[model samples]
Target chain A: MQTFHFDPVDLPPGIPAFRAEIRAFLAREMPRDYPAEQKANCWTVYDADFSRRLGERGWIGMHWSKTYGGHERSALERYVLMEELLAAGAPVGAHWIGDRQTAPAILRYGSESQKQRHVPRIARGEAFCCIGMSEPNAGSDLASVRTRAERLPDGRWKINGQKIWTTLAHRSHLIIVLARTSPADEKNRHAGLSQFLLEFDTPGLRVQPIVDLVGAKHFNEIFFEDCIVDAECLLGTEGQGWKQVTAELSLERSGPERYLSSIALFFELLRVVGPSPSESVRQAIGRVTAEIWTLRQMSLSVAGQLARGEDPYVEAAIVKDLGNVFEQALPPLVQALADDGIHLEQDSDFVRTLALLLQTSPSFSLRGGTREILRGIIARGLGLR
Target chain B: MSEQRQILADTADRLFADAVTSRRIEGFDAKLWQQTIEMGLPLLLAPEADGGAGGDWDDAGAVLHALGHHGVPIPLAENMIAAQLAADAGLELPSGPVSLATRVEGALQQAGTRFDGKLLGVPWGRHADAILAVVPGHTVLLRRTDATSLRHAHNLADEPRDDLIFDNAPAVCGPASDGTQASHLLALARCAQISGALEAALHKSVEYAQTRKQFGRAIGQFQAVQQQLAQFGAEVAAAMCATRAACRAATRGDASFQIAAAKLRCNLAIGFATSTAHQVHAAIGFTREFDLRQSTQRLWSWRTEGGNDRAWADVLGARVCARGDQFWADLTARDDAVSLT
Candidate 1:
């Protein structure tokens, strides 16, 4: 078996200057009295204005080419910006997907015209994108997707399919859809799939909200019936959608976002427990802190390997899988720690934030990829399958 | 890694890979110990002016990591720490292996270059040439011949862990050392060792799972085994990353929280790796006939050597709690957080 490498990664020498600039910007831009619950939902708290402000500072799409409105920064520079934004609980979801994966996808696979059209707008935070991968029956088994896209006589594509669990579909200006371009071969089930970029304004396409277990409207169910797209919208070569989508998913899974979803509650727990806490509370906090540090280092190593053009797919999967465990285990432990007789004022910011975090903790594992699927990928890399 | 560091690590790996076999760790071999010392393994962390390699913590940490991977059954790690301590105290480095102890169960009294105490759980204390003890005021080096008696013991790996009684023993004492900081430094050393052994345990388990057949197929084909191995891989990765950072912090001489966190994390990784390794190997892993026990048992023994998860976790938790509102700021601002040392 090939050995998995996770060398230690150091931020660039000038990272402190970049960190200081972001901190100063965040201090000046973030609201003075933002709601406590908002911090708990920072990843899903869409704010176009905040994203645009970050875009104005050349923070968004910092790793792409300058010709496409990017700042031509290193991957380490982008990593610094992302960690700082997540640590402060910034509202960056409005442009997070586009800046993170969609823009990179276009830059990597799209035609030059496509790059000039979408990459510039995404970098400016004036456009947004949502992924279309999961279907009603193909949640974990992505190769079983039945969405069909047929070539039309007028050189356009006609699509008919339903995508489920599409996050922020209604708000996005474009949807990157995966569909079957030809009949599936029994020998290679992953060969016949293809990808297309569909605008949200296309007729016969509808997005209906899928409210989560918590009373939040972050997910959607999109229905496409005879939805037509121009011939130029196809991403990369035809029949290579599975490969492109898998590459995009790698970018989705390997980032600071995977592990920092529960950090706000940790800060709140500190505020509530105060100084000189019991041994149990201290142990819990210490364990979580150690785990967080380890995960960040692992993620950073993956980022470093990615910067050097290495496909660290197995290591990235391991990070997301372990990251989910850390994030999911926090709320229950925090609840047990605070279950003592001490009464928390109902309106206290600490109590409100804890309540919100406890409600939303379950979704951490379901997003990006489920636990079982990620482990399966890890097992494949380990040569166990 | 620098070329020099890579060469040091490679040399250690080759030497220990031959000296450390399943047959060797079953019993102590004094000849193997002498061969190790002849290669200047113990002096890797000492100053150049003191007739040593004069390498930093990161350099020595790499060497110790390679030795740990081979489950080398000598006092190499302890001797490395002792030589550094002796250098810090401005004393002549000893000729043989030295064990370090910053705490003792019984009272240690000093009177005119003499010490009296009962030090417990000293690793390889029976075979050590000298005992480097950092007392409340001064750091003293006592020869093994001065010990009044010895109560021999063994850890999970069957390595010597002896208790020594010193009654008015003559010592070469030096200036006072920071006892607390010394303990934290030892903890960092132990973390480096544990991370290396964890990787070995994981590699062995994965190899076994692929080769061992069950029900007409490899056991690794089972989902249950695959999932367990995946978790073990994550634990190894975490331990290795944390240990590397702690070594860097040690080189900077500001290893307060980094060392504590690393020790705690490595201990946790050891717990998961040892148990899962035994489970994956089934009954064969429990027997001393197999190489898995060498690594797993050493992990079981090393986690509690410098300080276990509980001890270091308490120190780490107290520091974080004491920071109060400054916690978030310090955590995000790596400079402020690390400089708190």
Candidate 2:
């Protein structure tokens, strides 16, 4: 038997080609007027035309079914494309969540009409979706959502609740909301809730931007006050909202993207600062690289499991738990590397990247469930109480 | 490694639990040793030609993992590795309790045509049919009956480990050369054993943290405890990683620098596991009556033999700095390559 468990995963075939394609497209079509700071900021900036062009290449909904205008690619294939784009600072920002998570969930459990209406436009980059799960009262406690959706006399459901931390809601065309249809249902607290594809411009719908500590307009608080929607806007089945949302969170969490977000920095660090590194620096680099490789293997193992159609919830959590640490480690590590006179000042592109990542890495733990919560999940799965 | 090993480990574990109690260790558990020999363990290093399975590092590591898992008291690593060290040195290794002799430079020795020296901490030396002790110019293979003084220097693990004082032992009982003999081979073998013990300890720690509850939760559910187990697991893994890498170097006949690395890494692992395991096991672990005592105690002693961490680290540091020379680099490239199954 082979002793070494870790088999280094290549960043899928066609990645280098895809990378070239992205570079060529960005060079030719992208405006030279883009601020140097904004360009350096990478995929966080939304450019609809750039996203639409990417969608024209069938890159937006690359992992969805071809019938829905998707490219009909493997998750790994989509991964290679997205990972390369993210690493190279491609403007995937506009279509990021729509293609990454929301579209996939809709395809899996959305109504046929919902798929027909949303997916084609999503593929064409005409629509963007942000998740509506976290509410004012429920941050990590997702099941405690009180976003009530009551059936009205006009036969439309009226949703009246406020959701906080709704990323990109101001820019997104639609938001997938999980609302409680029956708070009185004792049989299942989670069962009475249902998901909906809500129009961002619906009457009584308002979005207030929540500026992060970094001063980026990344997330928002959305209030739905008597916002009525036809029953056709209902996603999947009623009362399966909690189960559906949990499945959606799985899509949010697992992937090489979780760790690969820092690779560009790794590449940059190696290039500008190779040879004759200090003992501590060399050891740190070696240690971090080995761990990165290990995390990649474990992540691929989970991907392989997912490819085989296994839910692999426990396995996925294990990868995410470990992967997040690597992500969270990158900024501080890059800073440490930068501190050795590598020059990570605001004016330097390297410094700009470092500043952005260092500002961003802390939230890696916050984004996909907190560190403590995921460890709890792992402990429970391992039967370690 | 896990599937085949779990079965072997589980089997031996059940039997070891029955025999080899604390009382069995202070005395010669001859029946258990005979049982292990019958079970084809002692011949582990004896090669296929010498009525042995001819298993390498991993095979031995698996058995050691199993032994540590159950706290089984038998010199699985020492007996076999010691025998191989003598064979590789081209001297007939006397079976049943032979000690490999170390040669120190700039040291006073009675200058004589007959190579005479004393060997210390010889694993299983007092019970051996023959002993291979290295003098300045020769690996003098001595018959146990021929040794002047062989006293049992009591070991933490109840097995027989002794210092063999030699007065004119026989020279080159086997065919290998004297200049070719080195303790690097012994260090590599000993490192494998220590790595196995570390892995076993981590596995036990994890198991204990998982099931043993405190204040209505598994101790592992506590982040402090989880962090400890996690770090311990990583250390054990790193040690195994280095050990397996060294094994690959040995297989490719590039065993110089790797021996030091494996020993150094394993030494670090043994210290951590022996200590952390008790923290997980807590008070009940203090009982020599408990199985945890066996593995932890062995870890304490193994660190002292075949050169300790300080000595190995110096050797490791010296070799690593010199590997940049082109010829040395090419020679040592394969040294760092190990099968990390």
lDDT of 2 by residue, B1-341 (tens): 34765566556655665675444465355667777777666667667765566766555655654565455555555566656665565544444644455532222234323435566766666666665555445445667776678788766876567776666644444334544334776676666667656766666677778788889987887877775565465456556655655564565565665566566666766766777889989998899777676677777877776668667655443333333222222321231232222
lDDT of 1 at A254: 93
Name the weakest run of 10 consecutive residues (lDDT summed) in model 2 chain B.
Answer: B332-341
Model 2 over residues A10-45: C-alpha lDDT tens digits? 244454455556557766866566543453335556
Model 1 agreement with the true structure over A257-347: per-residue lDDT tens digits: 8888888878888888888899989988888878887787788888989998999998998888888888888877887898785343577
**Model 2 DockQ, alpha carbons vs. true complex:** 0.09
lDDT of 1 at A370: 88
Interface RMSD of 2: 8.9
Residue B129 shift from truth in candidate 2, angstroms: 8.6
| Distance from true location, Cα of A61 in model 2, Å | 5.7
| Worst 10-residue lDDT window, candidate 2 chain A | A1-10
> Which residue segments of model 1 deviate by more than 4 Å?
A1-3, A342-345, B105-112, B335-341
Q: lDDT of model 1 at residue A220?
A: 96
Model 1 lDDT on a 0 to 1 scale: 0.83
